[model samples]
Target: MNALAAQALISARRALHQRGELAVRVAFYAIILVIFSALWSAAAGANGGSISGYDAHSLLWYVAAAEGSVIATKPRMIESIGWDISSGAIVTEMLRPASVVGLRLAAELGEALVRLVCSLAVGGVIVWLYVGQPPSAAGIALFVPASFLAVGCNLAAQHAFAGAAFWLRDARSTWFLYQKLVFLLGGMLLPLEFLPTALADVARALPFASMAYVPARLASGHVEPWLLLVQAAWLAGLLACAGGVFWAGERRLEVVGG
Candidate 1:
């Protein structure tokens, strides 16, 4: 890769490593897992039987995989774009030799990878202690491709949202709304299978499913291999659409005074 891309990756990695907020973010994920584990265990016991076809082990594994995927695909792009706009840093960045989108993409990917590692380590421990080990090695191997596609789709969706900063002076509200919708519709907290048939159909059709639901479902062995290919296709389509949005935004771009 060129020096610009290399520098972007270095800078992104450094930013995530040195940021004081890293601890807080890790703690947040751990706390969430603990809370959910307690709640799920209580409910499972009360039900006097399996809860939603999930034993404690399966439920915990699903939680770990789902949370890991979320951390892996967070919308750091929106935050970066907002900061650049508000501080008038876009002008300086635009003058650099690197492509702004390319640099941001590299940087955000680095950050996401860092967060994923931390989340998996911390979350994995929590799940192990409370629930037990994950599924067999084969199951984990099957999840690999789906997990990568999920992360890719997440990055594309976030960048697409961030591209809106080109026109809007303040995109924070939109960003917040998008995050909420993604978490809910993507089935981060509950499997989409639990949704009504019509709702589940719509959710599956949207790119959101490729973010968390599909990967988690695959990890849980709930999804068929044929459906895995469908998920990959959806991810590919979304990435293309996101690229088009980025190009269009760049074409119309004019950096306004902060």
Candidate 2:
């Protein structure tokens, strides 16, 4: 546990020092938020000034919240994990921790938490200036837990997907497909409500919605206690899936005399 914590801190500091790259990513994050907010605002204007329980102001805020957590991630999490496995780095990492997966997760978490804070700060400022006011105090309070779970669930799923590298020797294609799934089913660009009725239902049933939509929706002031429960359940399930995949991968390596 202490080792994991130290790894997280070291990763965080390393990420913090890469000011140029982090600045560019945060700028890109800000730009995407602005573009989406504008598009939603125009749509609302063309309609009756609101659509599907979302007005221009609230819609902007929603996009900010949704994308904030969604964008606060390692861009090549799955692909990098795959590369580590294929290059035999995972084997070396296994010597440092009882499980390579736990160490990698700890490192990623440290880096991601910093990025999450920066992304959320940019998002909050954008929405506040454009929309005039943020969500209610209670909604703001709940957003932290909801968004934390959102990030956790996403990372867990990515780790599970990365296990494909153990067998396939490549995770790029898998990463591509998984990203699209998150972009659609996870509602990274838009809320689940924007999806078709059937599609929305499926998204809700899956873990994807727990990644972005739940926290975003809650931050928009339509807090539902049940959605948090849904996020918790999915987090548990995805963590299990990740653990299972890595456990099997380790066994595979051992059997192969790696």
Q: Model-by-model lDDT, in order?
A: 0.71, 0.84
* Model 2 score (lDDT): 0.84
Off by over 4 Å in 1: 3-8, 73-79, 83-88, 226-228, 254-258
User: Candidate 1, residues 1-258: lDDT per residue as tens digits?
Assistant: 896468657965785766676777788889888887887677767887457777666666777777788876555557777667555677677677766666766666677767777777888788888866666555666666767667767876777777767667566756677776667788778777667889888988888887788767766646456656876787677667666765666566563334
CA RMSD, predictions in order: 2.8, 1.3
Model 2 per-residue lDDT tens digits across residues 119-209: 8998898888888776566777788899989888888899998998888778876777887888889887778888899999998898888
Shift in Å, residue 211, candidate 2? 1.0
Query: What's model 2's lDDT at 237?
Result: 95
Number of backbone clashes in candidate 1: 0
Query: How much is 126 displaced in model 2, in angstroms?
Result: 1.1
